[model samples]
Structures are given as structure tokens and as C-alpha cells.
Target: MPNTHRLSPVPSTLAVALALALISPLASADDASGTTPKDLDAVVVTASPLKGNTESVATPVDVLYGEDLDKAKAGTLGETVAKLPGVQTTYFGTGVGRPIIRGQEGPRVQVLSGGIGSMDASTVSADHAVSIEPFLADQIEVLKGPATLLFGSGAIGGAVNVVDGRLAESIPDQPLSGRAEVRGNTVNDERTGMFRLDGVNGNWVLHVDGLVRDTDDYDIPGVAILHDHEEGEEHEEAPQPNGTLPNSSVRTKAGAIGATYLGDRGYFGLAGSTYRSNYGIPAGAHVHGEEDHDHDHNGENDHEEHEEGPVRIDMVQNRLDLKAGVYNPASFLESINLRAAWNDYEHVELEGDEIGTRFTNEGYDARLEAVQKTWNGWRGAFGLQFGSTDFSAVGAEAFVPSTVTDTLGLFVLQQKDFGPWKLELGGRYDQVKLKPDDRASTDFSATNLSAAAIWRLSDGFDLRFGLDRSERAPTNEELFAGGTHVATQSIEIGDAALDTEKGVRAEIGAHWHTDRVDLKLAVYQTKFKDFIYLTDTGVEEEGYPVRLWTQDDATFTGAEAEAKIQLADTAAGAWDLRVYGDYVRAKLDGSGLRTVAFDVPHGDHTHGYEVDIAQGGYLPRIAPMRVGADLGWSLGGWRASLGAVRYSKQGDLAQNEEPSAGYTLVDAHVAYRWDRPASSWEVFLDGSNLTDEEARPHTSLLRDYAPLPGRGVAFGIRAYF
Candidate 1:
């Protein structure tokens, strides 16, 4: 029994009053000192094992910091970085989301913490949330294109690294330094607070950071259900509030502490962190019939009923990290860097206070690298990496079996400067083993090779090209799953005989930058010998549709472009215009292997259906084409921006999938800052969906039941001391 009461909308008068309060004139001073934006050639560490600037890297890289990061911050990593050139979110309600890069997601796109893998189970399913918090990050880096040579086969598509200064690499300039922020949003009465502090005493440095967040169910523009237009006798509609989605609330808290000792040559540090959260899963239950039904004279139920309820997840994680670096070391190595981390995570699914399922994961990752001095115009590093995880699920709704996975990899990278051109080459070898408690074990070996080049055509222009061959081993869920998944309303089946997935990718791009303009354009294509994907069988099991994990040949082609121009500059301020667009198309290569014909049960009745399993079709849940633009202005310590993004209709749908309509969203933000002798303070206001558009993200599996948030505003203040 769950609450079924309709929720009332937030009063318009309250929003107007808040807007007026935020717009009041306030005293502004000169721009903050030593806080200007970085140049285009900023150093990027994630692109290579060795340090390199953006201009020196052959692949495309996007970095967000300072005010830009604050403006893009959202509840999930996917939505926070969705505005980037070639990034999208697999939005599973407001509580869970993961980044989808270049139209590739799941195991293909790896998410990293600092320079190492996060070791979370977010990639295992759509409903699981990413474990990291964006509000505490100092900088986030997006490395586009293949990155398998450095991070292993999981990064065949790309990688996202969230850099938070938890483990101190260097001493702070001052003895004591810190920053704090507090914010609140009207969309769901959300409130968030965060703080970070660092202290230096003699040769020892210490760090501490923490954050807490809470929110109610978010608001929507219309009813939850997106009515189907088919001419039928009737379609049952659930009673929903006009402006709010049910069971969409969330609460989270996390903290970390670290200490480091600095010596003449290098530094060593250790850190420990803990994270806890409880969040409701929106529209996750599938009620085919009521708990009890009336019987007829023949001892059979005459009719069936449906019921809905609240579902939630309670999760916790504890992690420990160690880092060490030595400079000017003896022997063949000029420098050495070592990093290791261990994590213990667990989560339980609950249906109206009753436990439905529990998931647990314990893992550790370690990597060691040694950098060599320049030799014959070549400089690079060689490294060894090891990782292991034990994962298990119990209770009635466990869809995947318990398993242990282990991986070992060795890699080498080399770079040489040749006049106006730079060349880079890398290779890696990995061995992975998967062992299930109740099934046979499997092993896989993968070899990856990558080559890239950058040519400086002119003082303000450069050309880039890259090629890579990568392979990925199947995950445990794809090889041993055989159960009903209530979250997606489907009965899933896995094939243990599936083979490894191999892909070849080629890319070419150009970048131009100057004092007044910046532009980037890239085009890429990828072919897969064996690509693993989930397919619908056009049949029913129990009360749900049946889906199977399968493999086939596939291809993906896409392009992305972004440009910015200086509109005006005067004593008052500087104005700039920005435009960006991206598109990706995916298709299966071969024909069907067989045809499936069966009877699908609707309630208690059966209907016959047939589908060609061998017929080639488009991939499911692919993001549609998107185009957008923004205008920004900055004067002294004040800044303002406005932008709009339009998503095209998604008509190329897979078999048994529904199409999503296109919609546009508008947003705006304003901020003012004041600088003092020892600290700085800033206040800002951000508004989203200003037009109250009924926008639905095509990448979301629950788009028909959960639309995007309605019109709302957030105001906050930050302090640096």
C-alpha cells in the first residue's frame, strides 16, 4: 500500500517573489584576482599516461572548470555533462544517469575517478546511479574517442574522469585554505551543501571534504503517461498530479579525509571516504494483476486488477586510496608513480518497506607506472595494472548470478617530436577471468593497438588523425542471467556461448583557435566484428516480454562540431556567442538467423504474433540529432548567459520499440561576485525550462512515464577562504 494522493503545484506567486528578490541591485567590485579562466593549451593528464597539453594531444578533449562547471552542475553525471559537443545522458529518472559518449554506452564507456576506474556497478544496469558526486569536483575531463591503450578494453568508446583533490599531490600555498557552498532549488525543494578544507603544517598536509543533499519529487509539465494514439476500445490511465512525478525523491551524504607527507623528492598520501544514499525509483513497478482475485463457478479468476506502489533503494560505500610518487629515481626509471584503491559497496531494493533484493560488490584496483628520460627523441611510460571484484545478488528478484572477475594488463606508450608534427604509439595486452559460483568459468585475452598524429598546419590551426583496434570481453550479466527484471518489465535470458566483441575505429579532426574565435570539428566511423546487444523476442513469459542477449556485426558513423566567436568587447564587458551540434547513426549489418512466432498473453488472454529475428534493424535507445546555441556576457565581477537546445524527433526505432517526439528547452543564469583581501563571495541564480516545455529525452527508458522537470529556478552562494 503506497500513497496515491495527487500533489499540488508550487504557487506562482512564490516563484515571482523569489525572482524579484534575486534581481535586486547589489554592490559589485573589480574582478577576482588570480581567478581568470585558463587558456586553450591547459595541461591535460587523462589523455595520456605522461603529462601533455591540449594542443599536443591528437584526440579531442573537453575540460570544465570554475564558473563553467558551476553552471553545468546537475544531480547526475550524465545530465551535468550532457551539454558537451558529443555527450548525452541515459536519464533513468532524476536520481540515476550515466554518460553516453558518441552513441556508445554501458560497458563501452568507462567512468573514472582521478586517473583510475571507479569500480562501481553503474555500468551493470540502467537503474543504478553513479557513485561520484559532481558538486565536490575541482575539474571534469572528457576524453573523446578510443582510449583502450591506457585504460583497457572498457574504454573502447571513450572515458570521463572526475578529478577531486582528495589525495594531496602537493602542499597548499598557504597554511590554511578552504571553500564552501550552499544552494537550494525550487524544482523539487532540493537543498545541497558542500565544504572542502586543506591545511599545511611543516612537511605534513591534511585534507577534508563533505557534502549532503536532499530533494522531494520533481515537478513535470503534464501527466505522467504519454497516451498512445492507436484507435483501440480503451486504454487505462493512472491518476497523476498535474505538475509532479511520484516516487522521485532522493537523499545523499558523503565525507572524505586524507593526509600526506612531503619529502625532498616526492610525496605520499592516503585517504578514506564513505558515501550513503536512499532514493526512490520512479515508475519501476509492473503490476499485472492484484494480490487477490474473485473466483468463478469453475474455480478460475473471472477478471484481473492492477496496483502501483513506491519502490526505493538504500545504498552505502566505503573506500580507501593510496598514492605515492618518487622523482629522480635511480636505475632505468627517471620517475615512479603508484596508485591503489579498495572499495566495499552494497545496496538493497525495497518495495513498501519489504526487501525485494540486495546487491554487494567488493573490489580493488592498482596501477604502477615508471617514466623514462628522453631516448632517441622518444619519451613515454610503461605500466602494469591489476583489478579484481566479487559481486553477488540475493533475494527473489536477483537477475544476475554471483561471480568473481579478475583482470591483469600491461601497456607501453611512446611519443616523439618531429619538427612541426608529433606522433604517438601505444599498445596493451590484457587477461580477464570470470568465475560464477554456480556455473562454469570463462577466460578471455585481448590485445589493443593505437596510433595518432598531430600536425601544426599554421600558428592558429592544427590537424589530427587517430586509429585504434580494441576488444571487449562479455560481462557476467550478459553470460549467465536468467530471471525477471522488474525495473524494465522484462524476462531476460543470456547466452554463455557468446564470443568477444572487437571494434576498429578511425577519426579525423581539425581545431582552430585565436584571440577572437575557437572552433573544432571531427568525423568518425567504427565497425564491429561482433557487437553484443539486447534484442526483443516478440514473445511473453509469465506476465512480461522476453529479451535475449545476442551478438552481430554492426557499424556506427557520426560527426560533431562546435564554434565560438567574440561578439563585442568594451570597457564595460565582453560578449561571446557559441554554437554546437552532434549526430550519430547506428545499424546492424547482417540479416536474421531465424523467425520467432508465439502467443503473447495479455492479462489472461493470448494473442498471436510473429517477427523475423534475422532481419537487420536500428539499435535501440539511440540519441537523436541535437543542435544548440548560447550567448554570454561578462563585466567586472558580473556574468550572465542564455541558451536554447533543440532535439530532433527520433523516428528510426528498433522492433517492438516506440518513437519519441522532439522538443526544445531554454535556460538562463546570472551571477555577481565580491572579492576581499583574504576571501571571495559569489551569489548566482539559474533557471531551466523557462518556457515550461514538455520535453522528453529519447535516451531514457521511462520517457513515456517520466517527462523532464518543469520550469524551476535555483539560487545559491559560494565562499572561498
Candidate 2:
């Protein structure tokens, strides 16, 4: 058993009080001045190659920046964006999480840093954390649907881009400008601080940013395990006491520095960053048996014994990025933009104080895009992208073999406007080579095509349709892994013969906008020729269940809808009501032809029953349907919101899978800002799981072992100059 001690909440209470004190005066000032808040439209950069706003994009996009981002930021990327429609988080304890978009995760959804691949091993495993930190980001963009034309084969499902101004593309208006923030949370006794500084001297722009965060084990509402009993059932072990979860602490530090030379025609910049983290993995899951030992004649142990302790991960990453852009050139291309990044990442998994496994990845990605002036009423951009990675894992838990992968891709995007309609077309071709140190090399080539149209039916309504055929090559982990994954408590086996996955996606959506109302509804379906997924094998290896990476013809269908209504605009505030919902259903068509065995009877008309090998099964770990609503009020420099999200019970299950009960989580936030002549300061309070609901995300394999954090309040303050 693990320790059950809890941290005092005195600091949390003080932080909350400080925030309220800062906000009360602001609210009073707003009332005396009788000022009203202004609503501003948001701009998104990941939707397309060209600049576009959320309302103008052909597909759904969510952008978080400024005060909104600070209020919503969490320890992990998944939790930061979990409230968005069609998005769910796969929580691996409190230390690691990645977003699950539209029922797709792993390699299908790409996590990017400034429009390029993050070059991290997050996709290789669920317990791996994304390299980017939300605190240091200037903006985070979530682009829904197929984005292969823009990002590459890895973005067959969607893409999330974290934009940090480390490599400054443009110089700031002021010579020196920066921002700083401090935050504290009660649930985990977490404390965080971050700052960014930018200075310009003689056309040379310099940037520096740093962040530090530390947290203890998080508190929970109830016992770690729940037991159900009937009138005639045997009783098991009693439930553990409600307290903090053991081995759930986290500590992280990151920093970056960069410089840019800004000329009249173009700008070029380079940046280098380093990140370090040490986090404890949640305990209470499966534990392997101790190694065998031979006793001596005197009853002494023959082998050394290692102390048992919580599992943890110590990770470090060093990265460098180069960015350049030219406003105009004398060649055929009107302008050009270049971006490249090189990353060195490594992490060690420690059991107690002993290292169990170490993972390393060294990779580089480069892309060059050229824009052309309007030619024959069409505007477009063409780009070439290349990337290579060498990855290895060594130790007792080395599940996958060392591998090297190289990829090159070329893509073009064009758009034309005719009357009240706009048409966009794009195509990409990628060639990938994967070589395992101990296995035969495999080569894959894929061609992806996309088309979209937006037609204006009236002044405030638009209809959009999109079609895409995207292809993705299998990853090394999916093709070569064969070992136990301790975090998930499962034995994983991979199939080397799996083919590339190809998907055809069709989407139709409608957007309506008015001074008082904004609405969007989209429906989409994707059909795959070879959909790769992990399936339970109903077998056990070393006391752990087995999961095999397999491929099958599958289909995924989903819908998303959101509406925002402006109810009132008064001196007290601008009140708005918003409602959003999303759902996805994925199923395998049928079981392919495979060999099977059955019992035989002698001299009987019916010898035995035929068994169907794993066919017509639902996809595992898909997020349950969700519906949510929120009310917002903003006046002057103060803002407040109250919301609730209701997740439907997930009864649909694959073979040997269990169902998860439905849950509703309530959340609220309040913020106030104070503006000065040359600077601004803001304080906010955020509350989550106010009802203390026992919620478990169905998208996570650790749902049975770890539940979501309960009844937490956070206080934060930010300053900009």
C-alpha cells in the first residue's frame, strides 16, 4: 500500500482570497464607471495556409489565446482543451495526457509546434507527455477534420498547433515587451510561474522565456476503488480511504532563447530551447512478481534485493528551430517561408530508484513554402517537407526495437473565388521508409487529396462541404512492438505485415451568424480501407492482459454542433449562453478470413459450432457522447462563466471490454483585469468538478485505476507590459 498523507490547503485559500480582493475593486470601479464589455472576433492560423478567422474557415476550428488561454490552461495539453466540442483527453494519471480528436488518437492526430511536427515520442505511447507547455504558448489552435494537405500524413484525423514566439517572425512595436504569470491550484497544491521577455536593439530582436511548475499528489473525492455487491455475493477487500492519490506528483522546468535579424524585405530567426521534467506515475495498478532468488545454506539471499517504490519518469529534451520569411522576390514565386527544427529527446523510467527503461529519439523536420500572386483568378502556395527520426528503447521493458524512419513530401494548395462561392483544392504525396535494426526494411508511399467549397446562401448563412482521401503509413511501434507496457498493465504485440491506412472522409456543415447569435453544425463520416487499431486478445502474458495492434476495414461517423446566443448587453455585463454537443460511432465492418478451431464430435450431424474470429466489433477506447452548456457574463474588465458537461454512459463495447457510467461535471470561472497606461494586470479563479463527481474518461486505458481529479480550485494572476 502507498502513503495516504494529504497537503494542507492553507496556501490555496490565501491565493483564492488574494484573487477575490483584486477582483472586488475592479468590479466596483466598473459599476461606478458604467462601462460595457466589447466582443472581439478571434483569428486562427492552423485552418489553412493563408490567414483566416474561425468564422471564415471551411471546417471547425478552436483558438485559445490571451486571457482565455490562461484561464483554461492545465498541466497537460489534453486537459487544457478537453471542454471543446469533439475533443476528449486520454489521461495517464495527472502527469501525461494527449488529445483524442474525433475518436482518433495516437499517430492519426498530429501535435505540432508552430505548424510543424513536435518531433516528440508522444505518439508512441499514451503515457508519454507532449513536449510543448501551455503556459509558454502565445496561442493554441485546434483544427478539426482531415488536415493531410497542410500537415502531412500524420494529420489524417486532425492537428493541434502550439504557437510560441520563441523564433520571432516579426518585431514588436515597442522596443521591450513581455508577460508574466503566477498560478496556484488547491487540488494538487500546485504552484507555477512563467515569464516571456522580448527586446529589440538596432533591428535585432531578442526573446527569452522560462517556466517552472511543481505539484504534489492530487486529492480525490472518494475511495480509489468501488465494490458492488448483491444479496448472495462474496465480499472483497474494503475500499481505501479518500485522500490524495499516491505517486501523482509532477515537476517541470523549461526555457528558451532566440534572436532575429529584421530587415526591410524579410526576417530570419533562430531559437534553442530545453525542457526537463520529473513526474511520478500513479500506483495501485498491476505489479510484476519479484525475480527468483536462490537461498544459501545459512538462509541468506543469493541475489541482491531492490527496494520497492513508486514508478516515475525523468525526461529531458533539447530543441533548436530556424524560421525565415521573405516578403517579395524576383523569381516566379511572390514570397517564401522556411521553417525547420531539430530535437533530441530522452526519458528514463524508474522503478523505485532503479532505471527500468530508457527511450531516446533524435529527429529533424524541415519545410519550405512559396506563395504565388493571383494567377488566372487563383491564389495558392506550394511546399516541400522532409523529416527523419532515429529512435531506440533499451532496458528490461524495451517493447519496441530500434528503428530509423525517413520521409519526404510535396504538397500544393490552391483556392479560387467566384461570385459568392469559394473553392479550395489541395494534394500531397509522401514517400516513407522505415528500417528496423533487427528486421527487414519497409517502404510506403501515399497520395492524399482534398477539396472543399464554401457557398454563401444568404448574408448571414453559409454552407460548406469537404472531401478528403488521406493515407498514413504505420508507425514503428505499431509494426514492431512486442512486450509489456507497465503503465497500461497490458502486453502489446505488433504486426509487421500491416499495410498503410487509407481513409476517405466526407463532411458537410452549416454556419449561421448574426449580431446576437452564432451557430455551427457539422456532420462527417470516414471510411477506411485499412484502419489500424489495438484490440484485446483475451490472453495474458506475465500476469498482464494482451493487446495486439491489428488492421481492419472500419468506418467512423460523427457530428458536432455549437451555438452561442447573446442574451443581453447592459451596464452590468454582456451576457451570453452557449451550448455544444458532439458524438462519434466507430465499428469494424466484418472479420476478415482467418483460421479458427472448434471442438469435434464423433458420429453427430452437427459436430461443432463455427466461431467467428474477432469481427464486427466496436473500436476500443472511443470517447462517449457528450453535451454541454455554459453561460458567460462580461462587463468592463471583469468576466465570469458557469458551465456543465454531461457525458453519456458508454454501453457499446468491444470483446472483453467493460462499460463506463455517465457523469456530469460542473465548472466555473471568474476574472478581473486592471489596465494602466503602459501595462495591464489580471487575476482569475477557476473551479472544476465543483460537484465532486466520480468521473472516469472512457478514452483512457487507466480509467479503472485512476479517476479524474475532483473538486479543484485554481487562482492565477498575469501581467503584461
Candidate 3:
């Protein structure tokens, strides 16, 4: 169990805005012709698997678009997603990170690509990085709360989907389109280059993309935790550290190709990608703090040098997706569509081929939907989905004798739009069977239901209420995971008879938007009947933390708010400011059940803030709060833009008793674009963390042992043809 600490009132993080106003500089750019409206663009979010307003959906969703990525300065998908309201990052170091959703990690949250399941082994462990690259993505989506209906059994916590590859819709009529960029950063002394190219000829479209990144040991802003060892205290310190990166330095490379044929009826595509990396790892806190202990026992030597090694990971994945729809031509029964996908994934770890392990997973999913035009103001979708997975592992860490699981589900959904009011109802049924290579098979089935409503009181005012019941079956890992988890220094144990987890989630929310201001607020609560978790016994039973996977009944509740304000907008440019935050309280049943595996005790809270400003403000990580401006001018046949992002410190973490400190990161970018003939190119310079301020981010889960690297600089060139 975690050492509990007395609680403190939630800090007043919003007060920082007052201080920012007193320190920021004024915008100098002005409208050249003064004819354009000053209103901000209407931001739309597709959070649900179906189409709906972000504010009115029955489920909670966070949307990150390409523009949002620029403001975040996040190098990877894991880092960018951590800035969401209920999301957090568990960092092994700067190089390795996994998103923790509503306090659930690993398999609980599913990762997808292009609307289909991604079979990567990311869910198998925390130290592994997801293969998707945010830099090459069109958008990143978060399906917060229970998403068991759209995804399969593993989606009780939530889901993340990275939308990349070529889209039949985004393709231009000019036959070819592509973008190329180069960038560099200081923290890890890292450099990256990427290019995306696509071409359309008749009914065929082809796309190819690639990215390469490499860095040396990152430069630490503070003392290094791994180097603080005492030679003569063998019993004091924990086991070996996990990753290879010393400080923040890490390496990554990826490439992908996709092709599609667009016919009169629909479109189908095939895509494949490969990712490789070698990064640093930090020892668990329990292990790091005991390095000074003195022990002389069992005729054993007390002094031994700590061994440091990098964790190596490689992944390859292939997917096929098809979307087909038939239009009614008439208003009634407007359209019927079907979506299907298949994926194959392989992940391996190596300390050299002789050591480590490998896991392979393959899955298939298919969904059919029918949409109807309402005669009396009602329209929605009804669907059915089927999915299954086969998993296996080899080498030292392999779990069971390879297992296979099959699942089938059916769902019905309907939406009614009544002027200012909207209502939706959905229900799902699932049947699953797990077959092990050498054990009796387990079979289970569950049903889930959800209902929600929204009221638009006015042009810019809205209110929403939602409730849902969800269920999730155990994965192969939770039923058979064995051996030691090197980073956590825990001898992991699994429970085969664990029952399915079922829960109720509810939320009430409102949103207000105007030409100059936008605000959103929501209050949510969740109750779980059987929650799977890990419990610590505080004993080194097998040379590590004697921890076992368990389950219990629990309750959780929280509230969240997000807002953005338009400070200025003119024909020349515009600037804006934004902020967001959330707080949650979770507790187990009245039994006072000391601890259950993987469970966080009650009264835990998390919150964050962002400030941003620009002709077009951007916040990638936490939807930054900015106080800056943009300037644009035309010189000859070229247009130039200059902008700056003054990012505030990342927010505090709920899981940590003593949270890390926030820092100020200042970045500047200048770009010049050329307009000549049918081709154009852009050249720009970007400097991040310009002030060299020390900041610890949630993405750096190993902050106590590894601080982020300081200042960074990068130059890049982009072109479109």
C-alpha cells in the first residue's frame, strides 16, 4: 500500500492568470484591410464513435487536432495525450511513457489507429511506447469513460485513437499532395525529420510516411537519481533500473505506407508501420530510497556496483480497413454503412536476442450501421460489432501457454433532435470465450447500457446529463501475467478466477460560448461493482515487491472545467487564452479493505492549466494558456509570420504524494512561405524552453529519478507540392 499523507485543500492554480496579465507584452499586429470578422473559428470535436457535438455527447471525450499539437511541443503521442482532463502519463523516463486513464493503466485503456484496433503490445507493459506518431497524425481522439460498446472488452476505462494514413476525403484533385518537415529539440539534444507524401490517380490513392529521431543522454536539470548509489549497501537499494537513456537521451524511428481504392460505393485501404526504440528506465521509488541501508547477512558481500542497461523495444503492425455506405437518394433512411478492420502486431524486447521476450497479437473487428432521416425530428444509428484476439509470448517472460479469445456483440442506438433538446439511448450485448493452450477454457458474457440528453438553452449556452452501465472481461495478462516487472521491482501475480468488472458512470455538464469567450463545466461520478487492482504486501517474497492482482467494489467522483477567451483578432492576426482543470475522489467499499492490487486510495486529486496566445493560439499538451501575439506581413512574393508561445508549468499529479514543480517554457517560431506557380515551401526556426527553466512534466513519470533536459533549438523546412 502507498504511504498515505494528510490531505491539503486543492491549490488555487487559476490565480496564475492574474499574475500573467500583469507581466505579458501587448500585440503589435493590426488588420491590413480591416474587413475580416474578429470571431474565432467554431471548434468541432468527434469524441464518440458516432457523430455528435462534443459538449452534448453521452460520453466524455477530448479531441486534439493537428493545430493543438503545435502548441503542446510534445514529441510523441503519449506526451501529448497526458494533458487531457482525466488522463495522466506514467513515464519510465523522458523516452518512455504510457497514458494512465482514470487511474487505470495497461490493458484497461485501448489504443486504436484509423478507427480500428491496434494490436501493439503497449497494453502488455508500461515501459513500452505506442507505435503511433502524433506528428504525422491528422487528429488524436480520446474516448473517456466507458467505451465498451464500440471497442471490445478491454475498453472499460477508455480508449485512444490516432488518426493517420491517407484519407479518401482529404485527398486533393491535383493528383498529388505531401508535406515534409525537420525539427530539433534541446532537452535530450534530439533531432527529428519526417515526410508524408500521397498521390491520387483515378480511383487509386497511395500514401507513404517516415520519421527518424536520435539523441544522446539527455541533459538533466537536477541531480540524477540513478547515480546516487552507495556501494556497500546491497540490501538498501532496489533491483536494476529499467531503460538505457541516461538523463533524457533516447532514440526512435518509424515508417509507414498506406494505399486505398475509392469506388462508387466506398473505400478500402491497407496500411503497415514499424517502430523501434532504445530508452532509459528509472527504478521504482521503493527501490531507489533504500540504497543507503546497511546489511551484512548470509555470508554475502555488501558492496556491488549498480548495473545500468537500456530497455530495447521493437514493433511491427499491419492493418486493413474498409468503409462502405449507400445513400438513399431520398430523405428517408438516408444511408447505411459498414466498417470493418483487421490488425496483426508483434512486439519484442531485447538486451541482446538471448535475453528478454516477445508477444504477438492479432485481432479483427467489424461494425454495421444504419442511419435514418426522422419524419418527426429523430435520427441516429443502430449497429452490431464482432471482435476477437489471439495472443502469445515467448522467451524468459512469456506468460501462459498462449491463449485465444473470441467476442461477439450487438448494439442499438437512437438520437432525437428537438430544436434545443437532444436525447440518445444505447445498449450492447457481448459473449466471450477464452481458450488457453494447456488449461480449461473460460467463457463469459455481459450486457451494457447508456442514456444521455442535452438541452441547448440558447445560441451559446447548453446543458447535458448522461448515465451509463459498462462491463469488462479480464485480459490474458490479468489472468496469467507472471514474472518480475523490472521497473516496478515487483513480482507480478495474476488471478484466473477474477470476475468481470461492471460500473455505472454519470455526468452533468454545461457550456457557454461567445465571440470573445468560451467555457465548459462538468461533474461526474462512477461506481464499480468489481474493480481489478494490484495490492502490495510490503515484502520481498521473490526478490521484489510481493504484489498480487485483486478485485473489489469501489466508487469515484470528479468535476472538470475548460475555457478559452479571445483577446484579439484582426485581418492581420489574432491572439487567445485558454485554461482547463479537473478534480476526482475515489474510494473502495466500506470494508476499509486496506489495499487491493492496482487501486489508488480515496481523496486523490489532479488538476492542470495552460495559457496561450498567437494569430492562432495553440496548446498541444494541456491546450496551453497563452498570452502572446502573431504578426504577418507580405514582402514581394512571400508572406512571413512570427509567433511566440509562453507555456506555463504542467499541473500536479494525483497519484504522487509530493508532486513535482511546474516551470515556464518559452518558445519562438518564425516562418516564411513562398507563393509561386503551383508549388510552395516554408522555412522556420523553433526554440523551446527558451528560458532554460526547470520543469517536471507528468510525461516524465520518473521525475524523481530523471529530470527533463533543459533548453532546445530546432530549424526546419516544410513544403507542399
Q: Highest TM-score, which number?
A: 1
Residue 54 error, candidate 3, Å:
3.9
What is candidate 3's lDDT per residue for 493-546, written digit by digit as tens? Answer: 677788988889888877665555556666777888877765554445324454
Q: Which runs of model 1 end up more than 4 angstroms from their true locations? A: 1-41, 227-237, 284-308, 592-612
Window of ten residues with lowest summed lDDT in model 3:
611-620
Better of 1 and 3 by TM-score: 1
**lDDT of the candidates, in the order given:** 0.80, 0.80, 0.60
Highest lDDT against the true fold, candidate: 2
Query: What is candidate 1's lDDT per residue for 1-721, written digit by digit as tens?
Result: 1221111012212332332243221101111232222267575665366778667777667887788898999888888899998899997778788999998998888888777787777877778888888888888888888778778888888998888888876788999998999999999999999999999999888989999999999999987767422356353544655689888899999889989888889879899988888888776333331222122123234332223347788889889988898988966667888888899989888877778889899999888888888888999899998999999999866878999999999999999989989899888998989999988899988889988898987666678888988898889988877776776667677778888889998998877665556767777889988798888987666546778787889888777777776768999799998877787777788875666554433445755656567557778998888878899999999999999999888766777787799999999999999999999999999999999999888888778778889999999999998
Clashing residue pairs in candidate 1 are: 592-614, 593-614
**TM-score, candidate number 1:** 0.90
Model 2 residue 533 lDDT score: 86
- The sequence of per-residue lDDT tens digits that candidate 2 reaches over residues 64-166 is 8876687678888888887777888888878888988998998899988888788878888778888888889898899888778888898999988888888
Worst 10 residues of 2 by lDDT: 1-10
Instruction: Give the deviation of candidate 2 from the true structure as CA RMSD.
Output: 9.7
TM-score of 3: 0.79
In terms of lDDT, the poorest run of 10 residues in model 1 is 23-32
lDDT of 3: 0.60
- TM-score of every candidate relative to the true structure: 0.90, 0.88, 0.79
